[model samples]
Target: MFSTFARIRTLYSSTTFTNNTSIFRCIKTIAPSIDQCSNPFSGKGSCGRSVPNDDYFATIHHVSNIVRRDIYLERTLNKMHISRIVNSELVYRVLRSCCQHGIESFRFFNWARTQHPQYDPTTVEFEELLKTLARTAHWETMWKVVQQMKAQNIPISPSIVSFIIEHYGKRGLIDQAVELFNRLKNFGCSQTTEVYNAMLFALCEVKNFQGAYALIRRMIRKGTVPDKLTYSILVNGWCSAGKMREAQEFLEEMSRKGFNPPVRGRDLLIDGLLSAGYLESAKGLVRKMTKEGFVPDVGTFNSLAEAVCKTGEIDFCIDLFNDVCRLGLCPDTETYKIVITAAAKAGRIDEAFQILHRSIEAGHRPFPSLYAPILKAFFRRGQFDDAFSFFSDMKVKGHPPNRPLYTMLIKMCCRGGRFVEASNYLVEMTELNLLPMSRSFDTVTDGLKNCGKHDLAKRIEQLEISVKGI
Candidate 1:
């Protein structure tokens, strides 16, 4: 029996550990007869010292446990394609079992080196395993696995390089992404537009505009013409750095060469000017947009409105808002939110309320974003009557409270000692089939005690008990 496994292992090495089908057949037979050695090779290689029938029975029983676990965990859960919520310990258990049983585990390095394409070292499905590992944020484990593959001199593909760059970028590890990129280039992975774009986008995210700009120039110097999206990434980086003038120059350069860049280039120019308090400069560009038959989109209007509003020039914002409407454009909820928010910030609460009301009457719905500054302003000025009334109106209009809304309302009620009112709202919540959640209960419980309503607090506690079962 020991001689048989040694021959099998020899056959395995010669075939690069291929699934010959004959090997599994031999294992299926010999595994049940393995009374020979629990410690294969006396403690080292193939088979150990002689043992009895009960020892074989015990080993077979242990193999049963291992096989059962792998079938349920790695084979089943892994086959289901859901890695996140799946118990990682269970996978480790199954892998441990396989490794101990001299089996080729999923965790093993030479998993797919075989004659069959499906079991090939360079197969696409094998690559999917790496992709899944990278995507699931198992970077360390994946790095080790890829390195082991490298130790065997497997050809690392372009898509794998792209995968690494994207994984680091999405995880917001810019330096790690750049490091991986450098490593890829060092390994002679020819740079593609896709690779350059990934690195440029990552730099843009970290506000490393100058670095991204320098890389674009370097790529051009290397005769690797950056794509249109690469240019857009640089423009976005420039907008982040408040260098609207350079962005505009790039845009002009693209236009002169007949390269059609994104419409968002103009939008970024507007944002940079608006953010830097250059209202007139921003407006001049907007006018030029219309002059060039480039209808300013919703984003252009938003920046214009925000810039005008920042100057406490609501009148100009209103004019700009009308222009946006005149162009038959629907402003996003964020744009309307900014209008009211800036007004409320400037203590023009009345104007803010008027805009909010007009927005609603004009077929615009209340967005949760607009409520923050408006809520803070109203609460600061002791305008709960209006605030709670607006709250009621929002619900009646079929808009539900978001997390921030509930948090703000709870705080306001607690500060104002409105326990009775808070408890009443819970009743309303119950009526609407909305359970008073943890936050509600927290507010009410604290509010009642703070207000010296110990009896009411007891009742609220009882109500909590009644609802817990639900």
Candidate 2:
């Protein structure tokens, strides 16, 4: 909801902002009244005379844990190290404070870094701050830190080493992140799960199928059993790669390894198959679940039915409805909706009527969603009378049609040259607060245009524009 552009522009434009002012601005913006804390750092006594590094860290450990921005501000105010406060401590405190709270601290920390450009970049403490800032998604600050670090000796943590790589990896910085990975490797810190997951996720991100697969193999060899999350990543990556076969195989392998993959796995496979126009194949996968010693529950059927209908398989879904009855599985509301959708799509008016009748006989109460298919079914058959009748039924059931249902019915009425009925729904759209979208309005306007009703169209256009302002 926030614009990073505004913040970045503010950073680049500002000058003469010293660390104190920069930090104050940050605290003001992020910590909000951090200066008002009763325990504010009385900078004089907060710092000590010629303090050793370990003692400093030990004494301030409690301070470091202070998550309240007000407390941090109080500490910041009083804890100016007399020994020329190192850049690392500066960055780390700001970062630790932010991490304890949120990314809001970046504003203060970011302002702090830029205001002091002439500060030694190679100072070990400075490098630590830069790395922490980057880890918190501060890319603008990260690059500045990296350039300065390269210009001198700044020892980045092995964790920051990996984090820097990932920062680049996410923004498609594969080559640069790899270079940093190599640099960190020379320091004897090997790739860990976070490292591999970062690379795998990155490669999977841009569909670098071959590279991600190679990393998967490397991860397994290093004794990293792919977590359920990892498997899900691989599945989606495989689908994006147009290698459904591999996704299916990977799912089987995960199952064999005793990873009771989430129902989402089945969802992915069925959805992928349906999208590829493999309705029969999708059904086969669903059927196979039962044979694999996992009982196909209502959810399983619902997912497959929805997938089948979504992929434009109306007849197949209708057949599934009858088949489900024979299998003694009582269809739920979702199942009925799926079957009705298929009937509507296939324009099987008689079949849709039969299904609707059967749903009533079988005690399936109609919901608003059920109207999507039934309304579409009537519209497909050019039955404006029947469509309105069902629309009335929805109101009686205390489930008035929503925007989508309204749009569908309006389109049907307009296409069949029923401008009067279409206008009724346009008013209904306003009364229900379901502002018809641009496309929905277009459908109505087109109908009104054909019927030569400019005045009515203008009214709808006004409603649409007014809602956009809101």
Candidate 3:
């Protein structure tokens, strides 16, 4: 009997029941073992048998009752209208349950407000509802909720205001975000450093670096001293805008003020410099950061490696990668991938494969991205046999070909007048349910027809239709 209960407890703990209904179902399945009485309150066992007095059984019964109550409330809230004054606690519970179901909480909130003139939701409850609306991107509904809060003379918290500002900025509504930031006081919230940072981020997101700088000046004038984060934001903004000189100037100013820019800020400038073809400048910044006791992370090295590779400086990138390893920073999968790609692009296929072999021996799964450049290089050089051999090896190693890769191969075959191979690839794509883009398909079809393979062209078109149906 004890073993049976132990098994039941293990199952209960391991199972993840998603809803009240699943919980109720689980309870019903388990109840027969513990529910001894025909009447559960009769204090007897099943079939007139005696049962043990165990706390586990009592706890299970209590949990079952809670699940049952939640299920009942969900059904009742959907069907029953609130005619009398409902307690704020009950309203909060219903709102939470509605949120769980992804149902709009506004309807219940409206009903709760009308329940009684004095029945106001607590700030926490209101904030929870606002968060739900924001998460669902129901911006208009969120505004209505805010307006309702204002009508009730409830003070808007800084957290809520910041959330709205961030949301607006994310949606590219820069003007709306700025308007909200400016009206914090009108919303009965004070502008803190958090709000200031949020506004700066919004300004930076829109590439309004001049405005962000002006805002920083205004913050300083208003006695709101800019912190490290403030300087970082300005630096990042200038870097993103391709104004590396301005970014460097800001870093100097930050240092003069006795605050060094953060690692992330430096990384941003390094990325910007590398992207703008200032390789020497980016390397100098890295040396400066190291001199300042900031160890460059793997990401920083990877970014520089990838950027240098793009500029056809494969040897330089390899040396940099070796330096990273010598400094005791382990290269990640992305590091190997970038190096492999660069080697392949430089037509050093043997070196690329050597790196891939080393990475695989190091227990890294060969991702599709790592294979893409090599395959493309082979295809570009008209090495069809080698490309197909590698493609088969990729499948054997559990890195199955994806849609984009298949599309590229098919397009390459069609372009090279390998009509039979193109048709075979098209069939394989259809089997995998990967529909080629219409443009790619049209190109292949036209190529096949021009090559006098009318039947293959028709077959490809038929496969396209089948994929669309799927």
Candidate 4:
């Protein structure tokens, strides 16, 4: 039996059957007796059926043909005509493979329907295709597929309905989503909480707070109790729309209904308050959250610190950082980055360096953007030696100097009339394949020529041309 399978596999490998007739003939030749294996078409197998020694060979043959058919469809989709008839089972496997390739699924779907009028896709196959369309945001194609299903009287499942609703809602097609939800029965689906929640989420995502509230009333009228997730969705929607008053009212209503509004709701409210410049209110909420046994995470604190820093309350930012440490919550790289940015902006170079060093000790590899602020501060203060040393350290730590840093150094050197140093940095920039701005190169080249270094200026010009060609 094993020898038979090996020979068949070799035959398939050796032959390239472009048309379905040849492939089908090959399949028929290798197929074992019906009594030898479980019936592939019966959808059931009787117990104690006699097993054939060549059943494995038949199974391998089916799998190999399926793979070959898939490859043929993928490569010859544009040119090959489906003239030869294939079984529904093979067509189903080909459809599934097409779904995995995204948009090509639609092409194959259209081709399959036209080519094999007798082979109607099952519910599972349609569902998989719809899921693929939704995931890829092929909205128009999805609607067309849905229409085809309707015309064929195919039963649409609740999961498929939910996927369409959720995607339509996310794409801001709220009316279409709602219409689909209302027509659930037409599609032979029973309305459930999952469907209702999907609709509610869609409304919330589009900031249709009034529509969401009305939908909640409708849910109650239908005797469908709104779940905790339903209320949280509304609260988040209101908060995101900057309607803190309404958001808080919804939170109170959630509590009255014997549901503790989740931490996400409170976080959204806090974020909204901070964004609206209600710093005092935002801080009060943080305190309230802690008292309610819900400690704010590092991200929440970092947001507050950033907002406080923007208001020039550097002291308060420092106090918040100290509080984060006292609570035994280890500061993340973002937390340190925010503090460093604030310190650098305030010209507190020593404090910025201290924080940066601490971040490095805590295993955070510094980004070049993080170094920008302090580097600019050092350059402004005329601390040339300190700036060069910092640049050396950055390179040693595996961050070679980037274009902006080189540009800064070149501009500073030009301003100070350090033509020799500027020319050396220009060469290094070229060596690192980092191109400075054309204006910076022109400025340095002209400065060197004016300083009587004609040879070096000519070389710099040549380097600029070579780098540009690359």
Sorted by TM-score, highest first, which candidate order results?
4, 1, 3, 2
Two-way lDDT contest, 3 vs 4, winner: 4
Worst 10 residues of 3 by lDDT: 11-20
Q: Stretches of candidate 2 above 4 Å error?
A: 1-198, 204-228, 236-256, 264-312, 321-338, 350-369, 380-382, 403-470
The true-versus-predicted C-alpha distance at residue 29 of model 2, in Å, is 22
Angstrom error at residue 381, model 1 = 2.9
Give per-residue CA lDDT, model 3, range 202-262, as digits (tens): 8888888889888876886787766656776666667656688898786777667655545
Give the higher-TM-score candidate: 1 or 2.
1
For model 1, residues 326-353, the per-residue Cα lDDT tens digits are 6666767777787788777877787788
Overall lDDT per candidate, in order of appearance? 0.61, 0.60, 0.67, 0.68
Model 1 lowest lDDT segment of ten: 11-20
TM-score of 3: 0.51
Q: Of models 1 and 4, which has the larger lDDT? A: 4
Ranking of predictions according to lDDT: 4, 3, 1, 2
Q: Model 4, 215-298: lDDT tens per residue?
A: 876887787766656765676577667688898887677567655544455765776677557788888887786556565767
lDDT of 4: 0.68
RMSD of each: 19.0, 15.9, 14.9, 16.0
